[model samples]
Target chain A: MPLDIPLIGARTALWLVAQIHLFLAAFVLGAPIFIVISEWLGLQTRDPRYERLARETMKVVAIAYSLTAVFGVLFAFVLMGPYQLLTNYLFRALYPVWALYGLFILLETVCMYLYWYTWGPLSATTVRKWMHIGIGVVLNVLGTIVMLLMNAVAGFMNTPPKAIETATLWELVNNAAWWPLNLHRFLGNITFGGFVVALFAAFMFLTSRTGEDRKFYDWMGYIGNLIGVGALMTMPLAGYVLAKELFLYDAQLATFMMADKLSGYFVMQGLLVVLLFLGANFYMWLSMQRIEGGPRFAPHMKAVFGVLLAGGVIWVVPQNFFPDLLSKAPPGVSEQALILPERFAFLGLMVAKALAVTAIIIMTFVTYLLYRRARATGRIVWGRIDPMAQYVLIFIPAVAVYLMGLMGAIRSLTRMDYHVYGALKDLTPYWYVVTLGHSSVMAAITTVSFFLLLVFVFWVGFVMGKAHE
Target chain B: MSDPGTDPREARIEAVPLTPGAKGGWRRVKGPGIFALAGLAAIWVLLPMVSDSWGIRFGAPYRVFFSLAVLGSALFFILLNWGPIPAPGSPLTTFASIFLVYGATVGGVMSFGLWYYPQFEIPKPAVEQARAQERGKQAFLSPAANCFACHSIEALGIRGGTRGPDLSAVGAQAEARKSGTPAEDYIRESIVNPAACLTPLPASGLAECLPAADPARTYPPLMPPGFKDRLSDEQINDLVTFLMGLKGLAEQDGKSR
Candidate 1:
């Protein structure tokens, strides 16, 4: 934190600005995705309920979109003011992309308004609905593209590569971390929208004096929840990937994330993992007795959850407290980080690697078995799609898992730059073990839980449906 | 074999439904504890209320954004009809419509604040930023950047405009030529920030005409003072960057060189 007053304030201001921009941007990206899911669900199933949801969601989306445009203008003004220094610094090289960003923003705005306004006047033929969906996808693409450009500059500043001087806007546009972030964030946004929208729909459901409105909102809430949980279940992988990028980009930042003095954030993150897993696991357990096909799947999820609860506890354990007293110190205690190997060291060609592979296989087998009965119900009840569309949704979560893995691969650690770390002469083995071990466990649990959540949704939809016969 | 006649609602209670629908909707799914959405909206509204209590400094920009979020959420809730509207007669869209007004009302006031706020703290005259530019230009023609190294600016400063191109004559020339052309303007810009236009030196070949002062030293072409901090957004724009365009003078100064 060799921060000049102006620099720290400016950086904090920039992050806040970025966060604000991101918040608005997320709303824009997400609301449309929600609209599309409703359309796709409605269209494929010929369910007017889905159609009604789509129309209703689109109304909210239009208002949100206009607000997004308005806030963006506000953000631009802030960029000119308190964040002037940071914006100016990035603008020097980011001019080209910034231009595209301008054009893209214009394009997205026009399309969103036209798309929203046109919803009533537009026909609902397959082609038109597809076009509506297309507009949404393109808005997302353009919007995300604009954000990716901004992300590139922001990400570059945080972890600028050497080719910076020579790199054109395009090259920097496609930074190493950019796509993973795009992938991760896109999934997360869709997921967040689903949850938030569901919460909205659920409110409508509970309050509606009329049964028809109640059911309508309830269905919206349920589907919204599906998207939210599905996205939530898979997000950790992206976070993991992003975390790795954090490490490789700035080892110190990664160390801050892992086990440094700002350990609360790490603790929060671990606890998040433990909680998310435990939550998902409990849901799976809950779903087992209730789902249409699953007969004996309840306790197994409990076991997995029990394991996760243990991991959560393990995640919260203080780093390096125990081993410090037992071990004799190495020389030049100040350079102690130099004595102990990096967190990556333990992973380098060892029995640790073998166990990782074995552990993965075992878990996969268990999850596959757990979900077999659920999947045995031939038709996917909820959040199910045609093979082609499934292929598309598949890319989202698939990319999510890949990118999360990518985040953790490299090691770029700068000791929380702590004098305390130096005092220890080496990282306690416990700290190193817990850090990687917890992350790996988080990954395994998320992956398994993702499949479980996916199954859980179908189970809910199937069981929640009235007697069709 | 399974009974095709079975009630589906009793079978799957696992999913949290996001899109409650027009038909076959969330009637009576077998599960319980499905919290209603109004309560959730209350929580949504309630959770962020604690932000003020967090003891963080959210600047004017963030304050504006937070206001926008409140507006946005209000609209979302209205569209959804959160728990209950305060009044029975209220339209569902009223809350959101209100925020739109909020965005405009607040955003308009803030825009003006942004425009005028600098005057209060700086205590400088409104045109001081402009005068700084002129002072900078006065220094520019002297030994600032050696336009006199090749060109000249008598019309530019107290010094006669001969050592450089006759800038005193520039305004008159642009008027007389009325070719509706702009070569002289490009000249000043080139001398000051050379990278902008590589327009070859004037016919006098006075390209070597840089100043003696280290700030205006030769080998490093410098024309205007780099008062990057002083200029307003409007002032430092491309038009201003272009103002140093002594288009004809550089060529004239070059030929003399």
Candidate 2:
């Protein structure tokens, strides 16, 4: 946790490399299917529009395919560079899975290219559609399998199996956290892809000059937003499931994650959630205004936002502050620890639950109001450039990269050489900085990368998008 | 509304429609793509998986498969262009880079990779030197060799683990155990050959162990394995010099008697 610059930087870089590479890899595996589906749809409906979209989309997606391999190589180099020992140990235990992963990657690549290049060659309408589906299906299958294998490795680190008894490699490979992590990661990836695509669609729609392009762009944006939000909704669900599993498997880690001393922090966290809910509601209302007139339909939005903000402020107030007032009750009363007890802890949990419920109610009301307004007006703005949706394209990726950087330190802090969950060894040499310090450097690098991404995209969009607006 | 005169349903249908075979020319260009892709997928599933890596079952069907895959893939890499398809091209480029980096890596840091890492193929110790070191360290002090008493040692028969002095440590000061005067010199003069500086003592570990010349001094001689003729002059001197330096336990009194 206290890693210096170089090691943390190196570690962060490695994690970044891994994330970027894997994300690309996931896309590489998923995008062929996107093409196949588009093409297949075209064939089935006897529509050339779908076919054209598939060809052009495939070209755009090909850029991603080419870049992904570079990231993959970097990932391997980074893994081997700093964390060589951890890499080898992991390789030894989970070599079987890695080998399989390599094979799967090869299979995926061959399938992807063939599916892409062989586009016109598959003649019969029915046969080509079937072939297209086959490509999509295989790509998904291979991607899911690779992810599962990697998840097994990650899970092994989190909740180790009983490999120590006979110490066979399989026990080490089949870890407890694998399934939960895979499910979480799988959902998260879909959401990430969906939102990004939605944001892109929104951008394209905002910038298009022609009626057809604008319509297509708007539809894509709508689809992208839905994917982003849908995935986000499930993220919380997946998060809860992951938490429950973590608590059941390792209570000490769970307790540490929610330190007893940090009750005030918990309250503040609760309050922040409430605030986010309100902001999200306003944003969703703004999003729906493409349909609804927004301000008129969601008339109570400002008041609702205010109330949510006030509740957020209240939540933000230290939970212990009240107890503190009670404790200093104007007499020679002996003081207790600031927190009341387990009952109070349970009370804190309840408050958190209440906050979540309140946020959901606000969101639902906003959604309903917007829908009603849109239906009443039946107003369809043929073309309007909405720049705000594009903002999300920059925001989500940065936040994810930042959060991932933060969590990367957990392994460095918790795991020891040869004995993962055993007692923390007394002798940690100075060389640990090689891994720890690298993570810090990466976080800094990622921050800069994000800033550049935003500035460059915004500058380009403003320059290019005048006509459509 | 009866169109009996016009044959109503037939009249409503198109007078003439285009033939289904109209798109055959375009379809001709696209036909073989299906089989080409199928062939590719089949190749992926059929490759052999074998390596020296643990649990990588050897000398089996997989071995044959592995051989074929590696050889075939290598051949494919060499002979054909494969249309500059991105995946294979990328790996080949990376392979070259990895090799260059691996060379530097192996040069600088030790690892477990065969021919590259020291952990994998460590050299075994020589049998002769190993046997000699074993002789000097432990076997020479065994019960078969009575090397204690007059030349005292740390581990020996019940003599309070001391008598003459501890010779256990004489190895470090082998030169000082030779013939001489005072401490090293005295030890040096006494060990030129066993009888050269003969003392009045019986064989150690016996009930009659005693210093010589006193009739009632019934003590065993503490003489060790005779180096009388076995040792050369320079070697004898070195041995005496070494023995003399083993004087840490000289003042220790025997409690085992």
Candidate 3:
């Protein structure tokens, strides 16, 4: 039976709730990694600033943790209510996995709270600090298990193992796409967390009254961006391996993604990636300006920026203008006419796009190298950067969130008209590959709504901190 | 008197006070704004002409224009703001920055919606053989027969698996494989019983084909032979018809023996 909720329909409602849940969940999972690192650095260097940064970020994560759970519960309710058939089928197949996931969630929650609430008491002695870091390590492991447990379910939906009825739990959990999806999401979480931390720091830097506070926030933002961009640098390789696995599993499904139904979505993804590259490089360049020796390399950096821009343009070129195979050619246009001419066809091939992406990555790495060299030679005046740099920091996370939304949609929709791919078909009335336009609109809505809810989470954290003060 | 928590390097660094109004007020904004507008104008004027020259319309070029314009504007902004100018840190400016980036992303995606994938209205074949060939193509792609899993017809744009031979010129090539056998009979035999007559190995050897019976023998009988039971009689006939239609460019040019 088709379930319909009043205003937005069941699928849209589920999409909004699920996306918000995922955004917060990613942040909470991702933030703890850097938090633990900062805490460890503090212990090593005895630098109180690292300790302060870790604690301040943990405060945000603590409040956001509750919101993540709230949204997660809401996501479950939405799933069970409207997508009952799929939910029931998945539950029946992986009941033990689901139970294990729940157990891990509970363990992770406890570890997170213990790590947060014991910060003051644990920091007094070096032994206690090590013990505290131990709790954080445990929290990350538990969180990773939770994410991997769910990744199996998602991976199975797209590429289920053969003879699923007779397949063992291990076979089912280790589907063709499982490990790649885990690696991709593992890297994605860190990148998402890092950018979000930068987002928080950017907000603080812009509003900070004292030079000391501005200086600290500015330094924090740089560290956050560094982690985010560092992970981002390796994402293309992970994504490529994931795509190769998908293609090997089913060529037709891969064609449907790259050449037919979801091709335009990849173009949109390219645009966002270009924006991310530009924003990251621009921030690095602006960051260098605060270093006394940075001005000397401006000419080299400008050429690097130009190459990055050109490669981004090449990366987004399409083989054909048609949205998908189903749509008809316009009048006076042959099927051949709809496609790019043979001479330029190479530009749209996988080889060309891969090369372009490789070039962009190299250029970005070069930019980072230049920034580091400049920093080593000259003193960096933190908090002296233009406000525009902070804005760019904010911009990276927004694009990252939107990119995540679009990618999530692509992964789910790649099953095409099926709920569990070849095993179970989606026979509902709404079983079709959604239009790119509709998917884009949904992505935009979720991205904007996630940022708004994030603002609320930040405000609540501030209010609660003040109350305790 | 030094606090161990503070970085010692931080204390020695001198504060360079920012000259917020050094470049003058409105002049800073004016330069980048003009550059952005000019870039947009250049794209608007040049893209259509370039697209027309390439025999393209309403697709890749328009998206390229959108991407270039956004990137160009971003480049200009970065260039203009490379140094500390009078740009003040305000909540309003912050919100505007976010809105601008978000708006551009959303707009770039929606711009592709202007054109839909084109559908061609080709005339149906009047012959029964042609109709069967169409059905055969569908069966080739279907999971039941899954002929496409091991064979490829590059001419038809079907990039099937590399486990078997390239079937692009199979219709013409099959006739010469066995001395007296007809092309249709050879194809049918190959489908129903793949090991009946193995194609000779290329210079590179039978690595791409199924494992051969003898180590140094001809190509292996890689094609599965149980399709006679899997598909119905009519489906098999249709599939044969489709395979027969896959004549290579030589046959299309009427140069085949």
Candidate 4:
């Protein structure tokens, strides 16, 4: 049966809703990873600071979790009308997993609400607070399971095994690329959740007037940034492994992805990775001002900054080895010359990019080490950093949001007229290749729009807090 | 129950004297903060000047400049906002300033990048077997016309599976498959209207082979039909060229049908 929809294009609508939904989903999935840790830290140390941070984080998570569901339900109905056949097939294969996912969500929600509400009463004693931490552990487990179940469906589409006779439920669950995708998204969600929470901490830091409040947010922001950057540091390796799995599944498909029309996107992804590292480290540099002994380690910033600068530049070099139709040689030069001939042109290759990214990660870890040392040995120099540092805090999340959107766009479009890689082609009238310029513009708009919407969500949370008070 | 907010310890600390360093912290932030704000305002004003730069036929150096401009602006903010000050204004102002700064810098820079960067034009190549082969490779693997999905070309490390038997020798096989079917027509027909052709059995959907009987007859044709309408003539020909170059297994060693 022919499926047709009027007024709105199915692909565009689905893509728009899906991108927004994924961002929310990432937050919901990732927030609990840190929330549980925070709760555990609070329990072990008997520190009210950790306890307060966990409680506060849960408030934001509750709002995001609710919106995630709303968007997820909306996405399902929106796609159901236009992609009936594809939806039915996936539903048939994934109904069991879907049911499990729903069950896990229900459990997670119950645990989250209970964990948040019971904190004051249940934490009257050390034994009771440990119970609360256990509840948090349950909530986190349920959330991770839900994400895993969904990734099974997503992974199946990209790398369906050929042996139909052997395609049992277990085999389907263990699709060629399922584990790699699961690992990637698992780390990705943590990274996303940490950044969003950091975004909140930054917001609070900017608005804080009281010395105590500033100190609280400053520490909270450090923790959030720490978790996020730590997770982010490992993501490149996870992503590379996922890409390798894709290549092993279908060499031709992988080649088309890395070397053809989509080549420029890898260049773009490289740029985002570099930006992420820089943003994380710069925030660290700003953070040092709040510690008295931080200046002694301050001299180390120059070296760290140098590595980041050199590494970032090397990471984004366009390695365009394959004959990409989308990328052209500079005037008066051959395409080969654009990639080669230059002394440092080899940095464009994966090996060089890997080395650069690894070096950046190591240097950033050293920066973290110094921050810890400052906290240990130095006087508490709270409220010492410039007020503009708040803008830097604001800038990090903005760049992160932009990178997320850009990366999503690159991932979705690199499929290039396929709904499920090679299994199902997109046969719509709009199945033409989108120009790199057009794709980047769409990504930028989505990023900006999502950031604006997020601010609204944060504002809504703020209003809710006021109303409760 | 005791109220923590009404604690005597907290009340006593609230009356503690502020050190000179603590007092100066709030005062030092205003100048740099205002300077940064002014710089951002200037950038907002300069945005329009760059927005009208769409038609310029600049080269890579200009692209580099634009990229560096974005990186520089961000670093510029970091430098300007380097020290702490007493939190000024409300959360709303901070929010507004961030959005404003984002729009002026990242948004403006990206907008310029989008406008200035040239879109790729389709390649026009002189008739060469190598070029056709390359085009064919792209089409064969393209998610849009994924010929690699159903056919294995071991030479390319694409194990499309026994779903269509190995297409490694399809180049030699198609030419000799049926009467009145040339290699080109055979490959095109097979893609555009697969059910109408003789599809190999175990590859299609046959579970078990029958003794002394044709296996191709046991299974229904498996390939999705109607590629004629989906793909252009050029894409089809390119795919055909790719398939024809497969030539068979490595063990065949230059043998042709």
Candidate with top lDDT is: 3
- The DockQ-based CAPRI class assigned to model 3 is incorrect
lDDT of 4 by residue, A1-469 (tens): 1233445456556666777788888887788888878877766666566777788888888877777777788788766876665676677766888788888888878887887788789878878878888888888888888888888888877776666335788787788779998898899888888887877877776766677776667667777877888888889889889889888887866776677766666766676677677777777777776665676776677667667767776676566433364556666755443443344456557789889888888888888888777766755554555555556566666666666766666556655555555555543334455656666666666667667767777678764565587
The segments of candidate 1 whose C-alpha lies over 4 angstroms from its true place after superposition are A1-17, A245-263, A281-298, A315-318, A321-469, B1-257
TM-score of chain A of each: 0.64, 0.73, 0.97, 0.92
Mind giving the per-residue lDDT tens digits that candidate 4 earns over B224-251? 7778877888888888877776666542
lDDT of candidate 3 at residue A194, scale 0 to 100: 94
- In order, the Cα lDDT scores of the candidates are 0.43, 0.44, 0.78, 0.66
Q: Supply the global lDDT for candidate 3.
A: 0.78
Better of 2 and 4 by lDDT: 4
Name the lDDT value of residue B202 in candidate 2.
Answer: 35
At residue A430, give the lDDT of candidate 4: 43
Task: Return model 1's CA RMSD, one decimal.
Answer: 18.9
State the iRMSD of every prediction, in order shown.
Answer: 22.4, 27.9, 11.5, 11.2
The per-residue C-alpha lDDT of model 1 at residue A444 equals 36
In the range B1-257, model 1's lDDT, one tens digit per residue, is 12211324332323333222322323322111133334344435553464544433233322333343334333322222211123112434432333233234223322322332111112133224334444444444444233345444543233543433445334334433323335444433443344443322245343333323222322223334453433433434332322333334333222211
- Root-mean-square deviation (CA) per prediction: 18.9, 25.1, 14.6, 12.0
Per-residue CA lDDT of model 3 for A1-469, tens digit only, reads 2254656656788888999899999999999998998899888888777898899899989989998999899899988886777888789888889999999999999999999999999989999999999999999999999999999999999998867879988888899999999999999999999999998888777666578877788888988998999999888899888988999999988898898888887877877787788889999888876777777988888789879987987787677777777776767757765566656678789899999989999999999999878766776787778777787787898889989999999998899867888777653434567777677778888888888777676657753454587
Q: Which residue runs of candidate 3 sit more than 4 Å off their true CA positions?
A: A332-337, A463-469, B1-17, B24-82, B85-257
Q: Which CAPRI quality tier does the interface of model 2 achieve?
A: incorrect
Fraction of the native A-B contacts that model 4 recovers:
0.17
Question: Candidate 1: which docking quality band?
Answer: incorrect
